[model samples]
Target: MTELQSTAFVSEDKFAVAQVALYILAVLQVVAAVMLATGGAPIPFPQQATAMQRLSGTVNAVVMVLAFAVVYCLLARCLRRPTKLVWRIALGTFLTNFGMVVLTMVAQPGPSPVLTGCLCFAGIVSVLRGCKSVKAYSHS
Candidate 1:
């Protein structure tokens, strides 16, 4: 490879951890959905829960799982190409996720939520920095 090409090539090793992180989030979402759908008993529901509340929670869980799956796919794509588009997708995903975490913490404070938000913020910085090292190849 030419020196220019060598310098432009973004190391995949940098983003490998990001892909693994995405997988962890996806797995968590799937597990949460499964647990909620299976029993809805995981969380205490006072005397009883209305059908609407149960349905709403189940649907929400399913949506979260689906969203995470999409983000995971983007991360995989980024690992493969490290292109600008993939980096944008990763940035957008983490930005929204970080926003949600902040909102959740503000509305209802929790240790776990805080930790998750910090982790997501870190992921965003990691990806943005990694993206700086990549440039789409141009064949002349």
Candidate 2:
């Protein structure tokens, strides 16, 4: 094999863990989408949500779309090239998703506290994984 080809393969190894992190974030995004789409249950929201709350939901939806795009890009790059840039994208996705989760909890009622708590916990996982991936790639 050519030297450049061999070097490319070697460098790809550094990003294997990051690829896993990105895929995990993608799965979490899907989970969040399901929760938001289904309403998570039927939390009573006092006749109608206020304008601010409605705006928040709209924003959350937009964030989710962005998260999905990040996931797609990260996954594609990780699968195709496995570079540090892909890891950075995954980390960004995690932060965005976490922010959306927090916003949801603050702006809307969970079907129950338990559901919201579960989402928060999931968000924590994504954040932790993202951080770990960043550290791992940075060192490599």
Candidate 3:
């Protein structure tokens, strides 16, 4: 294959990896959201043992699920068309994941804090790689 064709192939592969990571992150977020809403061991630090807490937890859970759905849709689109819009969506996902890590650290200390932090970092790296791939492919 030509150099430009090779670059395009590599870009597609990178986007595939990123899409997989996004799906994994979405699943993780859904799990976390469930735990938050259920008053599980990993409940948020900002939460209290009150009706308000329960309500807030439910809201948080809903938001998490909705966010995951949106990300999944964006990932599908990105896979179909790896363009600027795709990179923007990936960046948004990275930022949102980062925000979740911060919120988790601030709201409560948990056994999985390290894991959560790592996951957020992974998301950031994946996003950066995907963006770079897109840029390289475009230039090629």
Candidate 4:
């Protein structure tokens, strides 16, 4: 078989890996959203806060969650096929989040932070694997 034909087989596997990674990120985002909606520390408000205060907090939390969701969706779309853009986006988002999670772990020293850091690390590895697969398939 020709090189292109051989690459087609490899590319499909890479695409599947990328899709699995995206699904994992999606699940993580959903958990984060639920936490935020139920008063994650990032969106903290006073226990006896006024209605307006609560409303504003909710709005802010929703906006934050949606922003991440949109980015994840965009990355998913890029995974429709192996393009450099997918690699770039996956690298940027996961790496940035991993760094931030590390910072949070250092600052907080809590179990949740440890868990989140682990998850973030997994995400970084998975994205790299997927992108590397894409690169290999592309060059074939």
Candidate 5:
């Protein structure tokens, strides 16, 4: 492993923004999983919803649980390897969120797809830059 990969000083400070984003993402995942599991409307929605909607909700809950696995994986990696894993996980989250944003935009039209996409894109870039910076910082 490179020097940065072996160091914590660079990873912790540089990854603060990404860490906050990951925390928010993790909470969102947990809420989504619970909402789906309970067969109720999540925070984004207000009503109890129809049978069809509930069925879809159940399906979404399953997917959300799986997505939350990524959060778990990142957490696990933080214990052993931050430099190598953070950027990859961020990229994965960004791609998955990006697709959801597009679907939400085209299918629902009530939310801001552009804004969501832009934010996700920015988060992904931040994470990548942070990772690169950490690596470079260690070398320097």
Candidate 6:
């Protein structure tokens, strides 16, 4: 490979972990959306939940999951040629996900939520570790 291309590849490797995490998050969001649509997702309901309440909860969850999926996909695409702003945004997203996971674990205390929280923590660490490389690439 040409020197320039090789350099680009090396830079890409720096951010690859974050990119993979974003892709995984996007895919998980999509899966959640599908599960919600098919009524297979576990959604909390009040003791006397009416049909309308169940429908409303499912629709809202589906919409939120789909929106987040779109955002994750877009962020992953931006990582192909990450800018400073993209890096900050990605870090912010990872932090936000981690925060939410913490809250979920506190409220629900389940294995599933703990696993999700671990993934979010890993994403945050990956992005932090690649900070210098992303800054260099942005400057270049």
Candidate number achieving the greatest lDDT relative to the actual structure: 6
**Cα lDDT of model 6 by residue, 1-140, tens digit:** 69999889766677677778888888889988999889778898988999999999899999999999999989988877778898899999999888988888889899877767777777888888888877788678
**Stretches of model 3 off by over 4 angstroms after superposition:** 1-12, 36-64, 76-80, 136-140
Worst 10 residues of 1 by lDDT: 131-140
The best-first sequence of candidates by lDDT reads 6, 4, 1, 3, 5, 2
Alpha carbon lDDT of each predicted model: 0.69, 0.55, 0.67, 0.70, 0.63, 0.85
RMSD of each: 5.7, 8.7, 5.7, 5.3, 7.7, 3.5
lDDT for 49 in candidate 2 is 91
Cα error, candidate 2, residue 110 (Å): 15
lDDT by residue for model 1 over 29-75, one digit each (tens)? Answer: 66666776787426455568897886786677677767777767658
What TM-score would you give candidate 4 relative to the actual structure?
A: 0.66
Across residues 33-56, which tens digit of lDDT does each residue of candidate 5 receive? 776677554434447777787677
Q: Candidate 4: minimum summed lDDT over ten consecutive residues — where?
A: 13-22
* C-alpha RMSD between model 2 and the true structure: 8.7
What total of clashing residue pairs does each candidate reach? Answer: 0, 0, 0, 0, 0, 0
Error of 1 at 105 (Å): 0.7
Which has the greatest TM-score? 6
Tens digit per residue, CA lDDT, model 2, 47-73: 579967865775677577557747554
**Could you tell which candidate, 1 or 3, scores higher by TM-score?**
1
Which wins on TM-score, candidate 5 or candidate 6? Answer: 6
lDDT of 3 at 100: 75
- Supply candidate 6's per-residue lDDT for 22: 87
What is the alpha-carbon lDDT for the whole of candidate 6? 0.85
61-125, model 4: which lDDT tens digit per residue? 77787677767767867776667776777777767877887888778778766765665566667
